[model samples]
Target: MNRRVLVPAAVLLSSLSFPLTITGASVALPDLTGDLNASPTAAQWVVTGYNLCFAAFLAFGGSLADLLGRRRLYAVGVSAFLLGSAWCAVAGDVGGLVAARLVAGVGAAIATATGQSSLASAFDGAARARVFGALGTVLGIGLAFGPTVSGFLVDLAGWRAVFWVPAVLAGLALLLCPALPPGRGSGQRVDWAGGALFTFGLGALIWVFVEAPVLGVAHPAVLAVVVAAVAGVAGFVRVERRAAAPMFDLALLGDRAFLGYALVAAAMMGLLVPLLVYLPSYFIDVVGVDPARAGLWMLVLTVPSVLLPGVGAALAKRSPRLLSTGAVLLASVGVVGLVGIGPDGAPWPALLLTGVGVGLTTGVVDGLALSSVPADRVGAAAGLFNTARLTAETVALAAAGSALTLLGGGQPDSGFTDALRVVVVVLGCAGVAAGLGAHALLRRVGR
Candidate 1:
């Protein structure tokens, strides 16, 4: 294959595996609980473990790619992911599976952190925009089909089959590794101290978000984690400012346009990811659909995602600010549409709206973030952009889950409906606020 086709194909394949693991694993959770005799907490970790590690190590992975050669790191990451997947497939208990997932998440972090930058290195100008759009298309397809595929796999082969899917994808990605253009490491030495502080800070922060809903935000343990996370983040900022080669370029934050684009990415993820994670359950438990059928229902949110990336790419060429503002506003309308969802409610309209909003904004915003940074620093910039997006997703999930628990009042039916309404309303407001904020920020930058 041509290097142009080969590199992006490999990166897209690797990128596709991450979301597949996320959505497919969620579908497998009930089966895992039964097979492993796991508690709700343990099952939750099956999802959280991967996300936590992925978020924590993302910047490290990107920095490493910049320092260690993107192709080499990409290969290493895929091999690790394949090994972790095989481990998960064979694990006998939830604890073992969770542990395996942590390993897989590390690999995912490395792969994802480098995936876009690799594309950036490979293509530029109109070609870059199209490739980025194509990358977005891959993401949407993975998310759209993940559940349905996992559902069939689980029904046919069992939950372990879900693990095997990513394993196979990783193996194929590894085969393409040699085709990637040679990547040179940045000559700068690794900032180990800065990396450690940032990792621990982000890790603690994510932990608090993941645990707060279960433990109560005011609980001593949660409070302690919060303080530690805060201190670690503050210390990390101090360390980065003083360090010769910081993991993140603190200087980039000064560019209001860059910051605005980053915020748009983060905010879009905050609204979209939680819905993807939770809506399948709503379809099953609330709408009384079987798991397999619920997967089909999820298409309402995911299908639009697959169809709109090209539109977003086209819009980006004309005006990214317009793309960001319009998409967010449209997504807010979708969220509002979701406010009254129930057993008899037709969710497809709201789902389509939300999906279109997210799909239209993501690629354009991602392109903006990448293009705003220096070429050599693309890896680091990708890490920072993704970190912010994932953090927002983690926090949104925690907050939404907590709201559900509080509003549900222990009643499975009515309580869940009430909780869903509350969460939808909040997400809607957030979408509007993010749209307006991005618009205002971009205007300020223009001024």
Candidate 2:
């Protein structure tokens, strides 16, 4: 294969593997819970642990790519991920699995932080858009297929089979490693203190979000974590201001276009990520669908995601503001349409619409964010953008899980339905806000 074809193929494979695990694991979670005798909270951690670690390490991973060569770190990340997947397959308990997932999440962080930057470095202008579109297409396929594949594996082999599949795919990615372009280290000093502070601070904050629903927000443990989070984050900002080279360029936050794109991406994930995490369970628990069938049903969401990225890229070229605003509004409509979904309701319509909205907006926002910054800082920009998006995903999952627990009271089924409704409403409102915000920001930029 030519270098152009070979590098993007490798990058996409490496990048798509993590998301496959994310959605696939969600499908496998119920089985894992039963086999491992996990409590609800513990089972939730199987997903949360991955998101938490991935989010925490993203910026650092990107910085590492800039400082240590993208291809080198990409290989390291894939190798670590393969090891983690193997560990998860053999793990005997929920705690062990969650721990293994944390390792895998670190690998995911490194791969994700570098994947787009590498592409940005290799391609420019229209080619960049096409590459991004292709990436989006791959992302859609991975997400679309993940649950169905996991469902079949679980039925035929077991939950462990899910981990094995990704491990195998990652191993293949390793073979293509030589295709990746060589990058010299930037030779800049990394702000270790700032990185540590930000990591701990974000960890503490996520802990509050994850634990607060179980432990009341007013509980002493929660209160203490909140204090630590505030202190750590505040200290991180202070440290960054003084550091010779900060992990994140705080100055980027001032760019209206960048900020707007970041917010839209964050909001999109806030709704979509949790839905992907929880929807499988809903199909099995509430609608009485078999795992395999439920997986097929999820295609309602994944199909549009697969098909729309190119269209989104085209629209973005014409008018990003219109692309973003229209996409968000469409997403809000889709979410709103989901408000009263019940055992008797048809899931495909609402899910397909939401997927279209999310899919379109995601492609455009991704391209916009990459274009918003200077080419040299692509790694840092990718890290910052993804960090925001994944952090929102983590928080959304925690909040949604909490709502299901608290509001469901004694009737677990009913409570879950209620929680889904609440989440849909909130996300719908957020989508509307994002749409309006994008219009305003783009208008200002145009002026």
Candidate with best TM-score = 2
TM-score per candidate, chains pooled: 0.90, 0.91
Candidate 1 on 234-319: residue-level lDDT in tens?
99999989988788787777777888888888888888877876676666666766667767777777777777777887877878
Local accuracy by lDDT, each model:
0.80, 0.80
lDDT of 2 by residue, 293-402 (tens): 87888878767777777788788888887777778788777887788777764456778888898888756687688798888876567767878888888878777766
Off by over 4 Å in 2: 1-6, 115-133, 345-347, 373-379, 409-412, 445-447
All-Cα superposition RMSD per candidate: 2.8, 2.5
Candidate 1 regions with alpha-carbon error over 4 angstroms: 1-6, 115-133, 182-187, 316-319, 373-380, 405-412, 444-447
TM-score, candidate number 2:
0.91
| TM-score, cand. 1 | 0.90
Pairs that clash in candidate 2? 408-415
